[model samples]
Target chain A: MPLLDVDYMLGLVPILLRYLPLTLQMAAVGMALALVLACGLAVIRVLRIPGLNAATLLFISFFRGTPLLVQLFLFYYGLPQLLAFLTQINGITATIMGLTLHFSAYMAESIRAAIVGVDRSQTEAALSIGMTNGQLMRRIVLPQATRVAVPTLMNYFIDMIKATSLAFTLGVTELMGATQKEAAGSFLYFEAFITVAIFYWLIVELLAWVQRRLETRLNEAYRR
Target chain B: MIKVEGLIKRFGGQAVLDGIDLAIEQGEIVVIIGPSGTGKSTLLRCLNFLERPDAGRLTIGDLNVDVTRATRADILTARRRTAFVFQNYALFANKTALQNIAEGLIVVNRWPKERAHARAREILERIGLADKADAYPASLSGGQQQRVGIGRAMAAQAEVILFDEPTSSLDPEWVEEVLGLMKRLAAERQTMLVVTHEMSFARDVADRVIFMEGGRIVEQGPPDQLFRAPQDPRTRDFLRQVLATQVALDVPD
Candidate 1:
């Protein structure tokens, strides 16, 4: 059992730092797509329209019940076999597709909870004041729901950052993939893994700090 | 001006409002009083289409609001002219008091933000909450939140405002402030329909007082007549019980 080599770990810092932007990009892109899809799904669920709502519920339940890694593999491998169109899609798109679907399902539930958390009487009040359904949702319900949902949604993004490590399984050379390649070439697994871990820690801490600031600002009106 | 004919509302086979008929004239303040679970609040809510009537004809001004037969557009038109205030002061918790007041004006009436804010400020001032305009409902006291609710209704320029136990959730000291505001509104000839347990406030401000029991209007008339000489035995019993409770509280230890 060799003692931990601080010098070797320090030397790998620059190499891992080079891959930082790629990791952040994957997380950022996945989150943006998930947010848009989640918003549509949440609105559908809240409105509870015929046929469309049932379909969305099935989509959400399926994505949420399964494992994200399995979903990623299915999108990257299984879907291409069934659909000739998806065969032409690149690995990055496949990974992003998997990440978006998996996260959007969870995000939809969080948003729906926030929407439901609003007082039922508020909707009645809005209707009594002559607001149409669309007007009520757009002007009253969603703006308030979004504020409540923001902190929870940010937590999902942080989780998605770590989740992007699974993208390496799809042949996308993101942060984790790059680290594996470096580890194999240098035969220094511990150093390479430690360097990547530190990079992720830094990014997660920064995001968590931002989330706190945002929650505070959103709740400024209620603060004494 | 409102007419309700054969109004019937049921929840899961339990009849809440069964075959109620009433006519209210312009510039009249009608206070509805009833025991819990007697459908007084539901009756006020149905007048504004907040709760759709299961069976009946509700005509506010010229629009019909019977869910069984009315067109969607007609129902929406009727709702615009009638606003409802909830017992819990259902002010939008996330918005400031001013934003709550301005929401209907900007969203429903399509007023510009500047114009809506100006009107909201004026209405808040009228409600005696000008100093707390920018505060959120969660930050305000229960009475202040109810005042914001009143201001929100006023800003919508509703022809008729419905109140469901507006002071039920307020403190004893705070109750007078809100009832005072309602009294001032009544004095200015604002058309209002209120469901309340405060017999004194109803007697003081309402043009007509209607007592309900078991989903029917048991007695209705001018406040002095109804309170002094309630025609029905049920009304007399209710008044006697309420007065007994007050008298028991007033006795020294």
Candidate 2:
């Protein structure tokens, strides 16, 4: 038996690449939904809205405390049994749901810190001028908070993209799922995994580049 | 006119503002001076309902709030009539100088963008920051930022402008520039309440100076009377400590 098979690994790269778009789509949809949910949660967390606060706290605690895989399984296998409306949820939907719920909890805290990290003066300034809370947040607090939270949010997105690999365990044939099948069919486990690993490394590199460019634009005002 | 009756605020178990009562006449520059941790800043905040007083009533022009029964709408109404200039300037870091000035007008007053921007630019010119209208707060010096903060308050057409140690966060050179702006506003007879450490500002610009310590107005009167002949011993001690530091700074090594 050959110790290594360069041809098999080289061929496996394209097989993995074929499924990369689905992986990206899963991450993109999940991250977008997560951002919106996180912002809402973060605001509720910040304001400590009466009855809603306990729910947000429970969500954050549950998501943060459990492993992502367990959450993915719960969504895939557990949710449909409990809720009639959720009975039709498919594997891909479940994967996205898990990613969004799991990541929203993390992003919410970052966004909350950014929102609260804004100077007390800024809130005072906005309020003293007669702005309602909604106007103040939309016009003053959120804009600044976005700048402060963008870097951290970008890092979350990168983590999210990688986390989409766990989607394969739910039987959604994303990149890692594609690689698992190819390796099983050819008995070239190392070749399949190395190819997938390179794909991950490249995706992270690409995202890092994008994050740097965005950070620079956002930081222009902060520079003297 | 601004009137506050029995305004009380607390933090944890300690009372921060202990039944404050005061009145400010129109076109008066009232300076509140006190040691750190005293309720001077809290009192200023209470006037506009920034730090909600636990009890009592506040009236600023037409906006009135009975602390015992004030609704959110009442607070908004009061805030509409007043403006606060923070110790740190508190300019919108994401906005240009003009945008910072125009934000309240556009967002709160519902002024058209064009009209609000025009007014903002005019205020910037009056504040001698017309050339810096496009600059972000981070790029501007502390003095410029504070001036923009002033411009923001002025643009609101507030009945009373509250300054919370406007010069506290500035460098020595920047302090005079800000004080000069405050002096001009005072000369125009803007109804204002200022909290400051600048004895000279309180001396030259204030119509009335209030000295506070331990959550109470220890003494209040014309600056001449308050500064030259403070009735309270605490006032005397605070002034002595502050003046000594000024003298120390002024002397050559």
Candidate 3:
């Protein structure tokens, strides 16, 4: 018996590729939702907003301390036991929730670092010109912070794309889920896994290219 | 007109500005000269509530704010009435030169964008940086950036402009251009309170000069009397040291 199945691996590409949209959908929705949630958390952390800040700290610690797979399982299988309304949540919704909460805890710190990294003089200058704290953040501070944040946020996004593979255990037929189904019937696990891995590698490489272009564009004003 | 009475600021247990009282007339250029760490910059920062004095009262025009109990409205009103030019230029790094000048007008005054841009363009022309409108702070030379910083302050058309050692951070070659722009502003009778180590510029432009040491004003007089014949021994010693340094720099290594 041959140790490899090159033809099966080649054929497996098309079958797995069929689930690319679902995989991208999960990552895209999770990334978009997480960005908003993460920015809010980062602001709360930066400002140290009284009682809300303590809760955010606990939320970040809980999400970041646990394994992503376990978090996905908790949302999929665990939450429904406590909350009756959560019982109707499908696997896709649960996976998206897991990704959003998990990644937002990490992204919030990066965003906060970027915001703080902005020079103190920038704040003073904005105030000297009569900017309220709110105006300063929107007009002066956040624009500069975004420049410092884009590269790191793109890194999180690429990680989120790979993390979508965890959605499979929740019974969502994404890229990895489809591969598992194909491998179970054919019993060619090596070919099936390698094809999905190649797809992930290609997606990461493509995003890294986009990241480079984006960083260059965002940093145009800063180039000496 | 601006008046700061019994202004006191502390950091930790130490007072950086200890019971300082000062007054400046409209369009008067008051130059503050002091040894480093003498609270000269802190005094200017306090007027706009940037440093938030622990105790004092700041009266600028009709708005009187007790520094210790200043509300957000008082702080905002004080800031709106005055503008600051920093030693580090502090031009918004993400913005172009034109945007830096226009930002105050748009944000503070709530002027229409076209009107703000038009005014900013005129100021750019006045500063002779009209050609570099699209250049970011990083792309400009230090002198150009400082010029933009001044232009930003100028665009506000505030009641007074506070310059905190605006030339201290510049390369030696760039100092004169900034000072020259300041001189032109002075010539126009603009109200300016400057903290600077440039004695020559202070001597030439200041309507009144103040010498501060250990967070207190030791002496103040017209620039001619202060520089030529200081009344206080402390002021004399400080000037002698400063002039000696300038003389030493004049000679080759």
Best by lDDT: 3
Reported per model, the fraction of native interface contacts reproduced equals 0.80, 0.81, 0.94
Q: Residues B108-138, candidate 3, lDDT per residue (tens digit)?
A: 8999999999999999999989999999999
Residue B57 in model 1: shift from native, Å? 1.8
Ranking by TM-score: 3, 1, 2
Candidate that would win on TM-score: 3
Off by over 4 Å in 1: A1-18, A47-50, B65-67, B246-253
Docking class of 1: medium
Candidate 1 or 2, higher DockQ? 1
* Model 2 per-residue lDDT tens digits across residues B7-53: 88999979998888899999999999999999888988887788888
The sequence of per-residue lDDT tens digits that candidate 1 reaches over residues B1-253 is 8889999999898899988999888789999987889999999887777778899987888776665687778778878888778889989877899999998889889999999999999998899988998898888988899989988887767778889999999988788889989999899988999998888887789999999998889999998888788888888878777757553222111
Residue A205 of model 1, lDDT score: 98
Error of 2 at B210 (Å): 3.3
lDDT of 2 at B237: 85
Give TM-scores for every candidate, taking all chains together and pairing residue i with residue i. 0.92, 0.87, 0.95
Q: For model 3, what TM-score is found for chain B?
A: 0.96
Report clashes for each candidate as comma-separated counts.
0, 0, 0
DockQ of 1: 0.67
Clashing pairs in 1: none
